[model samples]
Target: MTTILLLASLATLGYAAWYLILCSVSPWERCRRCHGARSHRTAIGTRRDCPRCDGTGIRVRIGRRLLDYIRTEYRAGSQ
Candidate 1:
């Protein structure tokens, strides 16, 4: 039981770390106009309005709910 739980925990931690990395590197991170630029010229697919620099040719994306699931998992583990 302990080994199983340990392996599961390790897997979860690895997944969480990967998720965090993806989120942090996601083009849609906090609407930054940097390398991870959102594919769309406009925020048509996103729920929020396009970032301010949209008109000026700035690609930005805000990651929505990326960490929410991981956070939920972490919270659940505590219980």
Candidate 2:
């Protein structure tokens, strides 16, 4: 039925939003915890191509944009 389809679509959308939130923690944040361990990869986030590393995944992101996006989602979720 159309009603059932609508509910399923809504559920899928909710799950996608949740997945994005869970993957916003980039590896750069972890480096702050342990000295000389900046090579760690993000456990839940993506590591896209970096010009400096030539896709070797050793480069750092310019800013903490991932954390910013996560904070925005958190605020929306709380409201």
Q: Estimate each model's TM-score.
A: 0.37, 0.32
What is the C-alpha lDDT profile of model 2 across 10-77, one tens digit per residue?
99999876655654545342323222333334567744343334444343433445666778999999
What's each prediction's clash count? Answer: 3, 0
Where's the lowest-lDDT run of ten residues in candidate 2?
29-38
Model 1 bad stretches (over 4 Å): 29-79
Which is the leading candidate under lDDT?
Answer: 1
CA lDDT of every candidate: 0.56, 0.55
lDDT of 1 by residue, 1-79 (tens): 9999999999999997776677667644333442234333444654333455443334333332646667789999999
